[model samples]
Target: MLSLILIGGSIFASCRKQIAVQSIPNMPVNYTIYDNSAQAIKLAKEGMLSITNVEVENTAIGYGGLLVVSRTITPSAEDLAYDLSCPYEVKQDVRVRPSKDNSFAVRCPVCGSVFNVAENGGAPIAGPAASSNSPRRMRQYRVIRQPDGIRIIN
Candidate 1:
């Protein structure tokens, strides 16, 4: 009976989800990028682009705009989209920029946190933010493929 109880407790512990150390207010994020648009064309060439949060044509640009990246050079590579806001700063104006030396990472100018944008979930890999008990990760949005282009939403 004791062994069973211990096993059950361990299972519960492992099931706990990791939570962000810092808190960021949720904001509306609904935007679409048409494949035929100039922005899409530019992204295809650059592989990365940052979009500022702005109101245009009834689309929500998200909390601090959006960071879109093409994971691979392949034409069919799926793009990943994340919020520009810095998790440690928690301010919409304070955002992370792509690392100059590494295309797969982003750095926060304010908190100095380096997030691995290329890996799973954009988790902080360096700086004070990652040393914390529960580090915060970049807020990501869902990108759904559309007939016209791609839709990003929270």
Candidate 2:
């Protein structure tokens, strides 16, 4: 009984650890990109976009906006979507910009933290995001793939 309890506790703790990203100010988000849209085309080609299409759906885009990435045309899983806000900064204005050279990683101009995007899990890979005593990953939103479009919500 003790062993089983210990195992369960360990599992829960690990899950918590994975979720220990710093919090950004709360902002509701509900955005969609239709299949025929330019954003969709870019995603299908494994390109990334920093989207701030506010008022499109009467919803806030995200804390600092949205960073959407696609790894495949017809991905088996979700197309990655994350809040542009730097988790290390935890402010709506402090956004992470994707590196011009690397489409799969973004760097915070303020904190110099780099995060892996797309299929890479949005985890901090370098700089303060990784080197901080309490390291944090990027804040991700749910990417729901639909027949007509991709709906991202937070």
Candidate 3:
């Protein structure tokens, strides 16, 4: 009789559903990393625009937010837009230096996940992230060209 009761209780508990909810930021992060138009133009000309590292707060959804600097890749230029988030583990360790190959790629310093910046920083040809259980892809931001500079937003 005790065995039967225990089995029923176990089954009931197993049937219960568990859900987790996370708090998300209401307002978009407005980063004016590029002070003016010249700076934006300079970045466009250079082909790569490196911005001052800013910490992003929201991290529960997928990957942590990032301080993305905005600049336009000319109308004729092939556009490559990527979020600062890392695809493998949702978020990457702070201070991971994105690769400088001009291929728009970023390498996770901690896990050595090489992301192809060309395709929203997706998993690249080789890296530890290649064998990860979660085959995640990087977030890509929409790029819009304004009269003054480029705008990257959600």
Candidate 4:
């Protein structure tokens, strides 16, 4: 009887789930948008990137409430990726704000959940975050460079 109880307890513990957010997979797609790298850096430095373009932002909201922004790094001009999804909940209403460390992150005003953008921008850092699930992963939009302009799509 004692051995059976121990075995059962171990099994239960082992079966516990891990809570983490996940994002859509990144695939090769074409996006026709402004390739102004300076604007991206400006937004990063400002600690906030608003969606002035309703069409673009709405498209993201339509597709799983997420959008990927691709920026071209200077000198190397390497591409950097980001998602517009709120890591706390699957809601398009949430907006990203800068963390105390000056990093781009999202804060769900409704739930007060903070998500860190530095680590892919989908993992909850503090407040009412899932403690059990897979490791939080954000969806990435594949960015392709074209001679005419930069293509960003997922």
Candidate 5:
């Protein structure tokens, strides 16, 4: 019985998907958006934004700016925030923006890679950026819901 349990645990652990470790810098993320504000409401509805050239103390990591993506998974009404940096190219400025069609995918204009932000934790669904050897996913940040707003944190 003990061996059977151990083998079962090992099989389950081995079946788990491997998470990609990106090279992007881990800078402090402390920003809030009021729920009633236009920006916040728009983000909640649209689910994506190309926040260009944001001023942050750690300019080294996000020199180009930051991209923000929001999604409301089923079973939880709260919106989740994800960093829009392309995992393939880890730089402060290399970020992804929403497609013109407003689909679930975000495209990296620099690399021509389009990632599906709403699926599989921002996995690279298509484009020139998809490589088997590369970390092909978007970095995510922590988002906490408040009574009046949502807080983004790294």
Candidate 6:
């Protein structure tokens, strides 16, 4: 009986879901965007932006510079930010871009993975990303609402 129980436990452990573990750049990220500005206003209306090749002070962390994909749920009220690099590829240059059809999805041109950014956190809806066994969602950052603007922290 003891041997059977041990075998069953081992089987269950082996069958457990595998989490994708990737190296994340550990640097301080403090980005701010003020409301009532032209860029902010436009972002409010569109609700999304594909920021690429941002030059942060520390290039050692996060793919060369900072590549971020941002979205606003309330359009000037709430902001959400995520790293744009595709988890499938660990490099920083492989970033995701917004779909051309105005869909709420971002596609990785490298691997042809489409992630639905319109929902809460960036979720893989289709393509090779959807089939990934680990690191399912895009890496997300912290967005905080401030009195004047919004602040993103990494």
Q: Estimate the Cα RMSD of every predicted model relative to the unseen true structure.
A: 3.8, 5.2, 9.2, 5.5, 5.8, 4.0
TM-score (all chains, Cα) for each model: 0.81, 0.77, 0.53, 0.55, 0.69, 0.71
Instruction: Write model 5 residue lDDT over 1-154, tens digit each, in one string.
Output: 9999999999998888755555556665666667787767778677665555444453322333445556552124445556657666666567777888547777787877777666566677776556554546776666687899877776
Please tell me which predicted candidate would have the highest lDDT against the true structure. 1
Worst 10 residues of 3 by lDDT: 18-27
RMSD (Cα, Å) of model 5? 5.8
Clashing pairs in 6: 20-134, 63-92
If ranked by TM-score, best first, what sequence of candidates would result? 1, 2, 6, 5, 4, 3
Q: Which structure among the candidates has the greatest TM-score?
A: 1
Prediction-by-prediction clash tally: 0, 0, 1, 9, 2, 2
Each model's lDDT: 0.81, 0.79, 0.48, 0.49, 0.64, 0.64
Q: Residue 43 of candidate 4: its Cα lDDT? A: 43
Q: Under the 3 Å rule for N, CA and C atoms, how many clashes does model 6 have?
A: 2
Q: Which ten residues in a row have the lowest lDDT in candidate 2?
A: 69-78
* lDDT of each residue in 1-154, candidate 2, tens digit only: 9999999999997777444455666678789889999888877775677886585657668788998887462144558788998998888778898787676788999989888885555788888888876778887888888999988997
Q: Please estimate how well model 5 matches the true structure, expressed as its whole-model Cα lDDT.
A: 0.64
For residues 38-147, write the lDDT of model 6, one tens digit per residue: 65776777667555544445322234233333444433344667777876665678788878864577788888877766664677777766786664667767778789
Candidate 4 residues lying further than 4 Å off, grouped into runs, are: 1-19, 23-33, 44-48, 55-83, 130-138, 145-150
Question: Of models 2 and 3, which has the larger TM-score?
Answer: 2
